[model samples]
Target chain A: MDQKRKDSASRSRRRFLTDSTAIIGGAVAAAAAPAGALADDKAPSNGNLPPNVPEWMKAPGADVGSQPYGTPSPFEKNVIRNIPKNQPQYTSSASRTPIQDLDGIITPNGLFYERHHGGIPEIDPAQHRLMIHGLVDKPLVLTVEDVRRFPSQSRIHFLECSGNPSYTAMKGKTASDLVGLVSCGEWTGVPLKILLQEAGIKPGAKWVIAEGADAAAMTRSIPIEKCLDDAMIVYSQNGERLRPAQGYPLRVFLPGFEGNMNIKWVRRLHITDEPVYSREETSKYTDLLPSGKARQFTFYMEAKSIITRPSGTQKIEKGFNEITGIAWSGHGKIAKVDVSVDGGKSWKAATLQEPVLTRALTRFRLPWTWDGSPVVIMSRATDETGYVQPSFEELTKPRGLNSFYHNNAIMRWQIAANGEVTNGNA
Target chain B: MATLKVAFAAAMLSLGMSATASAQTHYGIGRPATAAEIAGWNIDINREGTNLPPGSGNVAHGREVFEAQCSSCHGNKGEGGIGDKLVGGQGTLASAKPIKTVGSYWPYATTLFDYIRRAMPLNAPQSLSNDDVYALSAYLLSLNGIVPDTATLDAKSLAAIKMPNRDGFVADPRPDVKDKRCMKDCKP
Candidate 1:
């Protein structure tokens, strides 16, 4: 009886494979093809040829449990995160993501951009405790286990630093340093409103001050409107427990808010009537303008886009290729993105990839046939609220050169006749 | 199978509807926090002068604390070295290369007291006594010419002193710049 069932299953499997061979034959033949191919349809120029039978394939590789945790290949070692240029101290510095080397929307947890105020503190989850007090009717302290026991949701959202391209600071910076301050991840957590309601948010509560347990004791005042809307008490990122560099045990995750406001190693949430103008909010994150006034509490990262492929310091040949990159917004979903091959003179509609979630990175692509002529390439994104991303000149009009944070201006890259691309925004 | 799917979805829909009502459907997960626990972590300072500890320090003691604790990173005169510049930069917000120092652009004086008490001296955060934080705030205020050398800061006095750029901050005026969905013949 078992043999007959197994035989029927084998016949169905053979039939399914045979029927699909005609359509995706080459993909099915991937077993005979090289394991990986370079993006530009070229093999490794270092003579790692197919007929040569590379050394690794000639012998048995390392045993199964050799390295329990997975890692990037040694050849991909250079694809790691890097410290920003001119960062003075390692303790309070940033490790930016290499955007150009990555594809798709999700950034690997290991390669996600990290900006630490007091270096990574080795936090034991058992010792971690989150307190909710201030204007609440009943203040409550919750352990990590108690926090996890609440109804949780997984949301994919992008976390961006308010410090921005400010593009002045990133003048000569290339791909890794270009947009390294932003990354997207699926955060699993309980909504902050649930916790707030549990504490019986008092009538006077309008702003909640989130405080971290780091050496800097980083703190920021979040408006209650945002807290009830999409703020989360995240304990997990990209499926696994939060990485140590990314707040580990717990952190406050406010979708569409600035990175610094998503207080890491979060310990306390004090609901109050007024915004606590902490150093991170008032003095540092404030946006200074030309009229001697600065924009305070600028929480949302506006609509922005960048062409990662053929970006700064890249070489591409003249041929048919797809121009691809990522576009995102904090106000909501990316309603549309346009790609301009001849600078701002003209633009063509880009195809937004499927599953364009709100407050998440949306990959966009446009087909192009390059005739090897010198031209400017860039992208412009418009959010669901119809806020079109402005050019550098347009952005500089209202916000003077003094405004360093919240710069979401359109980025441009110049492709020379030699097929080399470099920074064209400046 | 189809009936089971419909039943499951109906249950989920009812569950979601109850979540919106919110008040009656408490999970009752976390326990009530103790006064001692709240006091230990309730360190944030609001601009309304509330929550400041009951201690005072004058500019004289402030200088000693500044020189010993802060001046290593922030310069002796608060001009900034390894840390951010805490003094000077007055009237520079509109100029090119605007040096936004505490005297020039910080909107509230209470933030200084709050930041120092919660996180300061880089190496030792929350290590400063409430009185020492008040002293450091007074010293910086005097150095920035915002207060007299004899000025002392208690919880009341520190929150009372208004920063020079008190009215210098504006709410987010975004959609501040605009452009259209021009596909071709766009202006350069």
Candidate 2:
């Protein structure tokens, strides 16, 4: 879809949802059903139960091409992104993907959380170009077509904002509001090494400053080691040309780096000996510590996970419950995910849903019996590298709460006797 | 899954043992960039003043530009409004509410110029002349008391004006916090 249409659709979806209560009812209904609610002693039949065939089964469903590009069910209209509230401006704002409402790994392109500095730009592929210069034998300026001409590879990776969990107004917030600045998807593009090798890297080039074409002309200095390692000049997200907001024609995808340095709408790659301390690298994105020294080039996103179902806002009825969440590590694949009930007092290993791709979100689920008592529940993910996801206290001790970015702390949700789930995390 | 990952790791390790990577085969696509083309898109300015463009600006000119172009979002004195606060907040990094403005926290002066040149005025970024950006940088730096009010900045002057917090940055010392695998009766 074009930028204009995509934007309108997004706005309309948000508008319709905000004005309707059916969406809220649907969400509560969604949580109540899907396995756990099967044993509920309430009246089973409400006209659509097993005895009576649902209205949909009695009639022919919509034929193919009804929605040529395809859209989610109308009932799922409220499963849209949470636009950043009270942002300074819409152009330089970020959005939260409704992660709580999603399952599996691949984030739909339209639903991918957006973090644009200068908003989305509609770039014509024919006119767009990517330049690679500085300390290279061949300083190449390739068109989008030329970029596609090179050999390409696809990888499933999780793109997370360093400032994920930027949500501050935690009261009554859903999991989406808590840790929504992250999404996992398949990125298809030419490995940057191939392009850089074609350009022939001259010695002494230690850093590459990737520049974006948005109004901000956003730029970030990336270590040349990362650029040549697993960096990619991605054109396709999931299986399609990237949604305009997700950096249309092209963008840089550093496999495990923090999202800011990924440089969406990437236009230029300038190899240099020293890091370019851009506004982003210095004035922003850096982590301030209690020692008064800010940590620079803090690229890797550490391991993090959150219990999506029964997390915040969502309610659960007594009886058998299925606890599910997502876990990921920038270093590599997740080694294990342990879910804890009774507020971290005891833990049980959750079954990790398979094809747990590296640097991508891994789905994990565990069966539980609620017993109708109040309890605090949470999940902890240990990465393959032996780095366990830290608690808020542990996380804040070293980095401090003001560090703001890279909040990979474990989240807790309190399940009351009445089935209301609330934020147990401070 | 753990076994699968281990097998995958072993295979990667073995592959690493015999890898002689890179350009045995080039698709021969993407022609070399022209000098003019390189100059057009090459807008990044490094901390060491590598890509600083020509032209100069002063605090006086920067003040005018700030009032005209920048102050709308950054506030009258860059104390911040819709945009971020760019001045003051000096020596508050270790404090509870560290206001991390450009003067107080930014390690290099060049970052200010680069940011203003590329993304200032919010509405019309990259429209600022290099001189205007330099002037704005000088003015903001002066407001933060890092530079003299009369100081003019070109590539050299801007690079030479060592920011107060230049040494305030350290390499990322991460994996700093470790979560022990505490299953039951954990420390609360």
Candidate 3:
């Protein structure tokens, strides 16, 4: 390391140590590279070996104000959301996080998966207004400042697109390609019930229609019961203000619901007696069954889990390897996750990491000794509701293969004799 | 379900506390919305044609608007160029290549009007007039062989038309998968 880099690293190290207790979910796990080990193979290219004075120690660094806002280290450039190449012309599309590259439960703000309708809208917070009308005693219009004035609450939760695992059933897909559509974050906002109470909802109000201010003016009808039950109008994501792609200024946060129901760029809430049955809810998110019948208002994303390390596109040595992954449920906390190294013939419970929060991504890990033979590794997550992650066969048996949304099947990664891992079904 | 009950209890407790707090001194947070402001943005139209604007359009006018504004993405014949294929795929839902087009899978005709009104023409969303949206819906429906080219679609007619898959949707019947948490002999 050069003098400037050394100084900066030391400063960061000091701050990291001091801010340990104040640190939120998965920050410590994110920084969990053993100090002595070089994170990359390129460490040999630079003459910064042990007993030699590092190059970064020879010069002074740039001033702090040089960058008004900081970004992740350049070494972490590979951690990115990957948009599939097929939908280049569809303005409203989704991109997946590189879940295979992540270390812990909390997805970094930059790498969080994005699913937008009518593209991302750049809204001026000053000009924006959130209107609450219909079936309310007081139809109020709240400014961004007025929204922040309410008593705030912060909660860590996971958001998954209901259509996440649909496109990955085909052969030859990577782990990130399979399960990268889900992400976790520490979301900060005011509880939605407080505002709804202030609005004085009418006795007959059953649904709350949340509308985004994007070009699509995207709309979804949420049950008023769910709104009072842990829904939040969030302004900040992770530790900072949300990225524009992640709905800057504000969004409706329905904990554990499908990502679309947690409407982004939110600006209006119209309480009504019935669901709007919008295009998304009826034509898109609904699950079609083998009987030609579809299931609508399937808001919850259900319990799901996927192994990240040694997943597809990764090669491993045939010895001691740690099988680590994340599991979460829209219903509630992940109660337990079982790992099946020999396909599903036998299973072992993985150790759940600390701070396993309700409806948040919980990290799970287990040690396995590879016998230098081909074997399939899979994980089954059981939520607090006692709902186990279903196999692809089990899922398709009831809902059929025609449904495009809510495919929360257990993913299987096959380890080859040559020490490469791939999707078993794929 | 128990979690939902617990959350409801918490919400009630918080609401009670805030109600007492409001009694002492009002936060006086948000301003009351004006009638004009409400009328300007409250543009949602339900399946009952509750909030649709007064408009009427024909297939001929719809073809003209779609070509001018939507052809870049939806193709000239609504066969899909860059956007999703809008026609065909009827009765293919149970087949191997089940293409979910506007005609094949959509459960409601109002959804077609609603989606086009709010989020269609990809590049210029919400840029279509209510009449143009009605025209577009007529044209698309005609292409799907659901309506005649001579038919004019207004709010009432649009809501009245039943979609091909109108009765295809069922309510969610969950807890579909059952497991006994076996540690051994899990798979035979």
Expressed as tens digits, the lDDT of each residue in B1-188 for candidate 2 is: 66675566457436752112223345788888999989877877877887899999999999999999988898999999988888888878999888888888988888887788788677888888888888988899889998899989899988887888989988888899987988878875
Measured by TM-score, how close is model 2 to the native structure? 0.89
lDDT at A32, model 2: 52
Q: Candidate 2 clashing pairs?
A: A162-A406
DockQ of every candidate: 0.42, 0.47, 0.41
Model 2 regions lying over 4 Å from their true place: A1-59, A166-172, B1-24
Q: What overall lDDT goes with each candidate model? A: 0.84, 0.84, 0.83
Off by over 4 Å in 3: A1-46, A167-172, B1-26
C-alpha TM-scores of all predictions: 0.88, 0.89, 0.88
Reproduced native contacts, each prediction: 0.71, 0.72, 0.55
Question: Which pairs clash (backbone N, Cα, C closer than 3 Å) in model 1?
Answer: none
Cα deviation in Å at residue A69, candidate 2? Answer: 0.8
Residue B162 local lDDT, model 3:
84
Candidates' chain B TM-scores in the order shown: 0.85, 0.86, 0.82
Model 3 DockQ, alpha carbons vs. true complex: 0.41
